[model samples]
Target: MKYISTRGKAPALNFEDVLLTGLASDGGLYVPETLPTFSAAEIGAMAAMDYPSLAQKIITPFVDGCIPDSDLAAIIADTYAEFRHSAVAPLVQLDHNQWVLELFHGPTLAFKDFALQLLGRLLDYVLERRQQKVVIMGATSGDTGSAAIEGCKRCSNIDIFILHPHQRVSEVQRRQMTTVVGDNIHNLAIEGNFDDCQAMVKASFANRAFLPEDRGLVAVNSINWARIMAQIVYYFYAAVALGAPARKTAFSVPTGNFGDIFAGYLAHNMGLPVERLVIATNRNDVLHRVLTTSSMRRQPLQHTLSPSMDITVSSNFERLLFDLYDRDGAAIADLLARFDEGEIAFSETAMARARSLFSSACVDDEQTCAQIAATWENCEYLLDPHSAIGVRAAMTAGIAADIPVVTLATAHPAKFPDAVKGAGLNEEVGLPLHLRDLFERPERCSVLPNDLAAVQSFMASNIRA
Candidate 1:
C-alpha cells in the first residue's frame, strides 16, 4: 500500500517510509493512497477470531510490502503480550445498548497502548533491519507520554523523548511518564499547555537541523500513519464483537488530537457497518466547534478535569479535510495556510458531508462530574474523566435504542484519581497491580521553558552517541 501526504506536495511513499517520515515533508499527515475494504463476509468472519489473530488480519494489509508476514505477526503477538487483559481490548455493557470498550488494559493504562506498543515493535524491526538510529519526539496532555515511553523504551535503535505540560496533567499521569527508568527515555515538563508542547514537536519535525545528520527524527504522536493504522483494529474488534455486518455499531470517542475517532472513520471506509461516529470533547473543543458551526478557529487551551482532551488544535482533522475536499492537496494547503493566519471555514459541501456521518457534543467539567457520579450510582461502573465525557456524549447522542453505541473508554480511572474523587464519590479508585506502587516510584524529568529552541537544544545534546 502507498501513502500520500494530505497537502499533496510530498512524494507518495510506501508504509515503511510513511512510518519513519511522519508529518510529511510538506507539513501534512500521510494517509493511505487507497483504503483496503473488507467484504461483508470478510468482516463477518472476524467474529470468531481472537484479539491477536484479528489484529494480524486487519493490520497485515497496511504493512504488506514493508515487513514480512511472519515478522509482522511476531511483532504484533509480542506487542499485545504486554497488555494485562486476556481480551486485550474488552467490552463492558452499561445499559441496554450502551457499552464501554475498555482500552486501558495495556502496560501504560491508556487507549494509546493499542497503537504505541505496536509502533515501538515495528520501529525495532524496521530499524534493526536497516541498521538505522532515530529520535522519537512526542507531546501529550496526559496519556500518550507514558504509553509512548513504555512502548519505545526497549527499542535499541531509538532514543525517545516525551513532553507534557508541567502541572497540567494528573499526578498519576505525570508519574506514569516520569517514573519509567531508561537511559533512552526522557520526559520534559514544559511550562505551557498541551498545545505549546505539541507545537514544539511539530516545529522540530519540520526542521531537524539540530539533530545529528545521521539520525532522523520520528513521531510517536497520532500523526504517524502506523499509529493510526494500529488503532483501526480495535474499532473493528469492538464492532465485530457487538455484531457488525449483521448489525451496525456506533462509536462515541473522547478525543483531543482527533486520531482515535479518525481511526473509526477509516474503519467505516474499510467496510465496517458503522451507524455513526460521535466526537466527544471537553472544554477545549475545536473538533466540536468545527462540526457544529463550521468555523475552525483557535482559542485559549483550557485546563479541565479531563486534562487529556484539553486541546484547541485537532491535528488529524486535516486528513479528513483532505478527503472532504476531494483529495485536493492544494485546497487543503490553502485552507490550512489561512488557518495559520487566523481562522478558516470549510466549504458548505464539506460541512454537509461531515455532518452526515458524525455528530458531536461538548461537555464541561460539571457535566463530566455528574455523568461520572451518575454512572457509578446506576451501573456501579467507575470512569475516568475522559471516559465520562464519552459516556455522557453517547447517552445523549440520540441513536436508536436497537443500535449499540460503544463509548471508547480511553483510560483507566486510576490514572485520574482527582477526577474520580471530584465526582463526589467517596470510593477510592486504586491503581492496577502493576501500577500500585506508581506513586512510590522515583521520577526523573527536566523542567524546560515553553520555547521550541530550548526543547530542540535539549534533544540535540541528550541523544546517545
Candidate 2:
C-alpha cells in the first residue's frame, strides 16, 4: 500500500518508506493512500484468533508488498512475546457496559509497547536487508521513550535517541528509559517541555544535512505511519472482544499526542463499528478546546499528574486535520500556518465532521485523583493518572447504557506512584518483577539544554562511526 503525506507536497511512498520517514519531507505526517477495509465476516473471524495471529491479519494489508506475510507473522509473534500477559491487550469489566482495556503489559509497561515493539522490529528488518545504518530520534512525554528504547535496543544497524522533558517525567518513567543498558540506546533529558523536544525532532527531520551522508534519519514517534498502523490493530482487538460489527462499541482514549485515538479513528474507517470515540485529556487540553470551542489555538503546556498527556501541541492532530480538509495538503498547510501564528477557526464542515464521531472531556488533577480513588473503592481497581482521566471521560460520555464503553488504560499504575499516593491511596504500587531493580540500575543519559544545535552536535559526536 502507498502512503501519502498529510501536507500533500511530499511524494507518495510505500509502507517501508513511510516507516523509515517518520515526518514527511513537507512537514506532514504520513497516512495510507487508501485504507484497507475488512468485511463483517472477516472482523468476526478474528474473534477466534490469538493476539499475534490477529495482528498479522490486521497489519498484513498495510505491509503486504513491503514484508512477506510469513516474515511479518514471525516478527509480530516475536514483538508480542515480550508482553507479560497472554491476552496482550486484555479487557476488564468495571460496570454493566463500562470496561478498561489494560494495555500496559508489555516490557515497558505502557500502551506504547503495543506499537513500538513492532516498530523496532520493522526498522531492524528493513535496515538489515538494505545493509544501511540510520538514526532514530523521538520526543516523548513519558512512556514512548522507554517503550521505543526497549523496542529498538537490540537493533545493531540503528542508534535510538529519545528526548524527554527533564524533571517533568515521573521517576519510574525517567528511569525506565535511562536504566536500559545498551550502547545504542541513548536518552536525552531536554530542559523544556514535551513540545520543545518534539520540535527539535521535527526540525532535525526537516534538515538532514547535519547528519552523515550514508546515514538516514528515522522516527520512532507516532508521526511514523508504522506506529499508527501498529496501534490500529488493538482497536480491532478490543472491539471484536466486545462483539463488534453486530454491536457497536465506544472508546474513551486518554490521548496526548493524538496518535492512540487517531488509531481508533482509522479503525472506524476500516469498518470496526466504533460508535463514538471520546478524546480524553488532562490539563493540557488543546484537543478538547479545539473540539469544543472550534478555537484551534495553542496554550502554555502544563506539567500535570498525567505527564504523558502534558502536551499543548498534539503533533498527530495534523493527520486528522488533513482528512478533515479532504486531503487538501495546501489547505492543511495554510490552516496550520495560521494556527502557528495564533488561533485559527476551523471550517464549519470540518468541525461538524470531527464532532460527529468525537466527544471530548478535559479533566484536571482533582478529578483525576477522584477517579482514581473512586475506581479503587467502587470497582476495586487502581488506575494510573492517565487512565483515570479516561475513566472520567467514559463515565461522562453519556453514551447509551447498552453500548459498551472501554477506557484505554494507557499505563500501569506503578509507573506513576506519586500520582497514586496523591490520590489518597495507601497501598504501595511496586514495579513489575523485571523492573524491581530499576532504581538500582545505573542510568546512562545526556542532560542537554533544549537547543537544537547543541543537541545535534552531541548526536554527531556520539553516533557510531
Q: Model 1, range 365-452, lDDT digits (tens) per residue? A: 9999999999999999999999999999998899999999999999999888778788999988888898889889999999999999
Q: List the residue pairs that clash in candidate 1.
A: none
Per-residue CA lDDT of candidate 2, range 1-465, in tens? Answer: 788988898999998888888888888888999989999999999899999998998899999678988899889999999999999999999899999999999999999999999999999999999998999999999999999999999999988889999899999999999999988888999999899999999899999878988889999889888888889988999999999878999999999899999999999999899999999999999999999988778878888999999999989999999899999999999988898898899988999999999999999999999999999999789999999999999999999999999999999999988888989999899898999999999988899998999999988877896
TM-score of every candidate:
0.99, 0.99
| Every candidate's lDDT | 0.93, 0.92
Prediction 2 global C-alpha lDDT: 0.92
**Candidate 1 TM-score over all chains jointly:** 0.99
